[model samples]
Target: MTDKAVSTIAELARDFGVTARTIRFYEAEGMISPERQGSQRLYHPRDRVRLKLILRGKRLGFSLAEIREIIDLYDSAPGERGQLDFFLDMIEKRRVDLEQKRRDIDLTLSELAEVERNCRNRLSELAKGREQA
Candidate 1:
């Protein structure tokens, strides 16, 4: 869409593959402010961009408050540099957390496999003993 192109909340939701309620939640949270056209919410290109950023942040495990802080810096005195630095820090933290979670999951899977193997072995031993008896 063009820089000046505007869209309705329904259009934005459809394009973003999100529910209208989700958009409304973001709106209520002061994330995206659409134009009010006699009860209809008309979203402009700027709001659309913000919504995209918000969704991207959510996917990256950032909270709405964090996303808002980053987006606010875009037009604030801190400018692009501050936003980038903050986002990078968030990315690093999230990466570390995710790596720890991966390790935990791997360890759990390994434990499960060992338990299964032991159960299979016990069953096999019982079957052989029954056959001999």
Candidate 2:
């Protein structure tokens, strides 16, 4: 309800399964701004939510710049519509990129399998020639 201390940096790191330094890095990157009280940093609900979004975006392979755009859009004049539209576009782009990666990986695996089969057949032929000798 208020911008009070909902969690400390350590608490957020423990809950989010990230290191304190990582949270600090986000703070430094202007992604999330926690309230600073002398030596201790207190995270409010907004900070917590933003941290969650940052982690999720990272897991989804989003760059820090892309994630920042989404987070900034959430607070800008366009609000949720801009945020949602941008996120949708990002999702589509990510999908296409991942699909291409998948195809490349599949092609690499097929080539590897072919190489392995050739290697085994060469080994078999060598063994047969030795036995005939």
Candidate 3:
């Protein structure tokens, strides 16, 4: 099969709407390996896809270490099934964490609304007192 097209680091960064520094940081973190053309870095299409997944994983609250673990699993020698199982475990854990966060946020919003109502009532009472005076 013919090799896929590769792009310069700058091109990849522009395509992904991320900074070159961010891509380099991922490389430093062992998240991706780009080909080097002298001092310049070239990224294959596979690297581009990996970068996309890395960014998406970050947005989903995955830490760099966690993302690296997941990425490594896919690249592991034993098999993809083991990695798939590990990913499923991670997904389950994240679901629980997200549910807790949702509950906490709901509670916080309710408290905030109560505080706002109290403040409005107090202000209304103060305004009435001033009007009477």
Candidate 4:
């Protein structure tokens, strides 16, 4: 294979800012499939691209199962409009979930602020009582 078409596991890990163990984990999860050269693993360009996509999917908070579904489509439906539609649907679902999480967080933070304010007010009252006593 041409050098441009193949890469070592270390090379891919370094290039992608990931650990060798992370690559191995992805390989184990079937997210990437590197060819075995004796005890060494040689990654093809396709594997490299899949690793990049896997990392991107993780960064976007997608579960491995979801990432696997999307990655599987690359081979199963290359250049198909159906794939685009499916991907768009997934994106909308993710967006709705994330927005709901954001709203929940906002409410939690507001409640925390009110609790903190009450605690501080109580502390000030106690301090004033002690001073007056």
Q: Which numbered prediction scores highest in lDDT against the true structure?
A: 2
Q: In model 2, how large is the Cα lDDT of residue 105?
A: 100
Of candidates 4 and 1, the better by TM-score: 1
Better of 1 and 3 by TM-score: 1
Provide the lowest-lDDT 10-residue window in model 2: 1-10
Question: Taking the tens digit of each residue's C-alpha lDDT, what string does model 1 give over 1-133?
Answer: 3344888878888889999999999999988999998999999888998999999999998888889999998987778998899889989999999999999999999999999999999999999999999
Cα error, candidate 4, residue 37 (Å): 2.2
Model 3 CA deviation exceeding 4 Å by range: 1-4
Q: List runs of model 1 lying over 4 Å from the truth.
A: 1-4
- TM-score of every candidate relative to the true structure: 0.92, 0.95, 0.85, 0.89
State candidate 3's TM-score.
0.85
lDDT of 4 by residue, 1-133 (tens): 2347888988888888889999999999988999998999999998987898889888988899988888888777564465567768888999999999999999999999999999999999999999999
Model 4 segments more than 4 A misplaced: 1-3, 78-80
lDDT per residue for candidate 2 within 18-67, as digits (tens), equals: 89999999999989898889999989888988988999999999999999
The TM-score, computed over Cα atoms with residue i paired to residue i, of candidate 2 is: 0.95
- State the C-alpha lDDT per candidate: 0.91, 0.92, 0.86, 0.87
Flag clash pairs in model 2.
none
Top TM-score model: 2
- Candidate 4: global Cα-lDDT? 0.87
Model 2 segments more than 4 A misplaced = 1-5
TM-score of candidate 1 relative to the true fold: 0.92
